[model samples]
Target: MSKASDLKRITELRRELKRHDELYYRDAQPEIEDREYDRLKAELAELEAVHPELSLIDSPTVRVGDDRVEGFASYQHHLPMQSLDNTYSQDEFFAFVARVEKGLEVDGARFTVEPKIDGVAVSLTYENGAFVRAVTRGNGIEGDDVTENARLIKAIPKRLKGDSIPEIIEIRGEIYMRNEEFERVNALRSEAGLELFKNPRNLAAGTIKMLDRVEVGKRQLDIVLYGLGYCQPSVVSSQSEYHRRLGDWGLPVVEAFWEATGPEEAWQAIEKLDTLRNGFEYPTDGAVIKLDSFDQQDVLGATSKAPRWAIAFKFAAEQAETKLNAITIQVGRTGVLTPVAELEPVQLAGTTVSRATLHNREEMARKDVRAGDFVVIEKAGEIIPAVVRVLTEKRPADSEAFVFPETCPSCGTEVTQLEGEVAVRCVNIECPDQVRGRLEHFASRQCMDIEGLGVAVVEQLVSRGSVSNISDIYRLDYEQVVSLDKFAEKSARNLLAAIEASKRVELWRLLHGLGIPQVGAAAAKDLAKAFGGVRELGEASLEKLVELDGIGEKTASGIVAYFQDERNRAIIDALFEAGMNPKAPERPKEGEAVLAGKTFVITGTLPTMKRDEAKALIESKGGKVSGSVSKKTDFLVAGEAAGSKLTKAESLGVKVIDEATLLEMSQ
Candidate 1:
């Protein structure tokens, strides 16, 4: 191509890549897949190399994309946090190794290969061997301060362990969500009628930048530190040595690593990592190969964007082409209609893939998925099956787009899409599918702890018209239950007894079981602690709800809306009449409640009482229990082997108390 054409293409590519960078980094949304983005960047780099004069200094190829945004203080790094150059092809990877060898003037230089964790990059700063702050990798040079949220991750030690700790250091790593945690959080969001987070990476990116520490804590983010940024003493001399030092310091590091002689061995290691990544708790999208010797790395130097010593080889997502036989709509507990693509069964990721989530109506239109069209499907985040794209070229001549129904399939209710929302929901409270899901959730162990209320039993109860709502569970007749399909006299009696016992459970359980939007188990506990009883909580204003630690404006409004609904009010009233009185925590008289309005963190094994017992004692006296120690912590109850939390409390000057002292204070 001529210089003029190259310039035109480069201009367009720069503009496009910049938009994608904004979507991916600052906004936590990406329109294209990682490989596609890489291809675009790679093309621009080639074009720019051909015509260096056409390349501007601020081009995407020469600089790291900025992730900085509002609501966070910018923290300038002591050393720049650079990104790694990525390649999808093995030949390009070998080329990178060849370049490294030529630059260092050496053959078969040792290398370190480890899984490239798919997560948000952050730098953790330690001062005098104590964790001081956490900062995001915002434009490499400067980042957002997220110390408060980072403290909530239990895996991150407040103080470095082992000997020879650096006086001051910036520990670099990726903050990620485990697959189990991701599914759990998505379940809660689905229950709350909120749009589900698409993947763990996006969720983690958004979560770390959240303004509310309380909300951040509830989701449970974790970290894996492998990169070294700025060290005071610069103890480690190699990548392998740094990893060893990280492990000794009690920092979470990559589960597996491979030392290689050169690119051939590095590729083998990458292949091995790919095979084993499915069993890992965290998401590993690819493998990073870095030159082992720190001296060699320094000598080779780096570009303005990435290091010369390292490269990331991203693995292509496993995909299979399947015929989209039909599209089905599923009504969730919150009445949100999710469109699912029913595919002709094809094997993918060790499972027979018959269905994939189209997510919602908007996604279907964006992808233009049609019923008769062949579609490419892949496991999203190695968990959910999703339709990637439609095979439009091979489409049936008479194929048509999958039109989302205006009414709920489960019920004849007309669906409504709320303003500024993509979800088309069936607002019918009595939708059969929704009722079944709600009943199942209310009876789950996390909520009311009702036993023998499995899906089959709930299905039987609903189908028989013996139970319609959560309130119906309380009013079930023993005779009616015994006569059900699988219920015997003994099982029926146990279930009835369990139902009876649930009435006297802690108030938080009842609150959670009620299925208020945005009110998960954690939020329910906060609400129970603040309001004491369901009746009191119902009468509290939105302002009062928002005043609670974890309860944000959206959650507060959800609570208010739940209470304002006359139907929900009637359910509560009915529950009260059915001998249902959830036991609120005993409130002490003003002078006697010495621990009132204070937060305490319990650590180590106590002399007599267990941690839960100590927590219960504190909560009973109007105090709160926190999982971690912070400046806001009024007291740290210490005992035998009170590890990092005790050290943190001492550092922050938070008062340390023994179990005996706690007992005395309560008395």
Candidate 2:
């Protein structure tokens, strides 16, 4: 290729990659798969390496997070939260270590290795003993202030614990959502007629930057402190000590880290960390190794983009070759249609990889996935099995693009993707699969606590036409139940007794069991306490629903829409007729709420009461139970073998109370 053409191609690649980076970092929307983006980036890097004279100063390789999202009050960082250099192979990682050694003029330098968490990076500021502010790592030199959102993370302390806190500190951390929590959030979004977030990292970035703290609080987020950005009084000496102090100060710190003395040791640690990534609840894509000593880091210094002392060893995404045998559409309870890939069973990431989510038709189109085509599948975070890309070389000559069915496979109803939504829906309330799902959820332990009601029973009852809706479970005749496939005379009687016991549940349980879209257990409890019963919630105006704390406009509209459904209203009538009438939340007796104006940290095991029992007692009397001890904690409820919370409470000079004292105060 000519030098002019090579230069032109490099310029075009930079332009395209810069746009992709903006979509990813600033807008929280990615147009292409991660692997494709990596390919383009690799191509550009290779071209620039060969033609060093043509390398532009403002190339994508030299910049970090250039997209400054608007609407955030930006603050200039005291110390830049720089990006890390990524290496996809072990050889490259070793090469990075060699460079570090050469730059420092040292031999067998110690390194700290930990999982490279794939999430939003933020800078936290602590003043004295209090959490002062937090900001997103925007454009490296400046960031968006997100102090309100950061406070909602329970893993982070509002106030420092123990006596080791410095006068001030700037901590760097990654705020992330667990894979399971991300799935749950997507479920709620689907129910609320909102678009599902493509991945966890994007959701983390969006959630942290939201203006409304109440909405942020609804979705629980967690964070783990990793490094120190700026510290006053020069308190910490090493990376390992920083972690120890983080835990001592009642902050969430990553525990999966190892110390290594050389490249071979670091290589072994990286392999072990890769294997352990699957077990972590949060997503991790690679391993990051940094020089262990702060003094050493100072000596090595950094470049304009990333620190020279640290390098991120990205695990070449673990993928398996599989054939897409068939595509099946799953009908969720809210009637959203999701496609699942039925693959020829293959091993991936230590497990049999037979199925993966296609998300929706839009995702299927973007990936160009089709039935009978050979494809590459990867576990996103070693948890969510996703089809990363297609292997077109192995495709059969007769292979055809998959046609997503336009009709409901279960009920034969004509389906359509609602306006502005990608999910195709049956829209048929009488669909048998939907009925079975609703019944299953209504009787689950978290809802009605109905024992002896399992999936088999629900399926059998639904198939036999005994249960048509949630209320039909209460109307089940004991004599007819014994006639089912698995029910014995004793078991049938016990099932009937259990059904009778479920009638006296609180309003919150009934609210949750109704299978209302966008309504979760916590939301049900809040609605129950605010409006008292289903009748009140159903009849309340939109203004009243919105007036409640934490109930957003979308949630308010969903509550109104659910009550407006004729079929749902009929089921509620059936519930009332079957003697399952629910009442308002129970009110505590006047003046008995002695635990007000105090925060108590409970640890270890109590002899007299279970943790839940003790927590209920405290909350019923207006006291708050905290997960960790802090200087603001009024008392620490000490029990047998109380651990770090106890030590922190003692060091902070907070009062220590026994179970007896706790019980006495509640009384």
The number of the candidate with the highest lDDT is 1
Measured with C-alpha atoms, the lDDT of residue 22 in candidate 2 is: 64
Error (Å) of candidate 1 at residue 477 is 3.1
| Span of 10 residues, lowest total lDDT, candidate 1 | 54-63
Q: Which candidate is the best by TM-score?
A: 1
Runs with alpha carbons beyond 4 Å of true place in candidate 2: 31-39, 49-62, 326-375, 379-667
Compared to the true structure, candidate 2 yields what TM-score?
0.54
Per-residue lDDT tens digits for candidate 2, residues 1-667, read 9888888789778767766776677666666655567788789879999997555322452256543443467665667789887777888888988998998888898999998898889988988989999988876756788887888998888899897677889999899998778889988755432346667887888888776678788897989888898888888889988878888898888859899999999999999997788888777888889998999899988865689999888787678988999999988777778899999999886567899888898999888898998888886444457787898888889888888888988898999876756788988988888888788778865478676676777778899999888888888897878987756898789888989989888788899888887676656877886777888889988998876544557678989999999888999988989998676665567897788657787766678875556767887886666544655578889887675567667777889999999988887
Ten-residue region with minimum lDDT total, candidate 2: 54-63
Residue-by-residue lDDT tens digits, candidate 1, 304-342: 668999999988778999899999999988999998999
Query: How many clashes in each candidate?
Result: 0, 0
The list of candidate 1 runs beyond 4 A from truth reads 1-257, 261-264, 275-316, 380-382, 585-589, 592-667
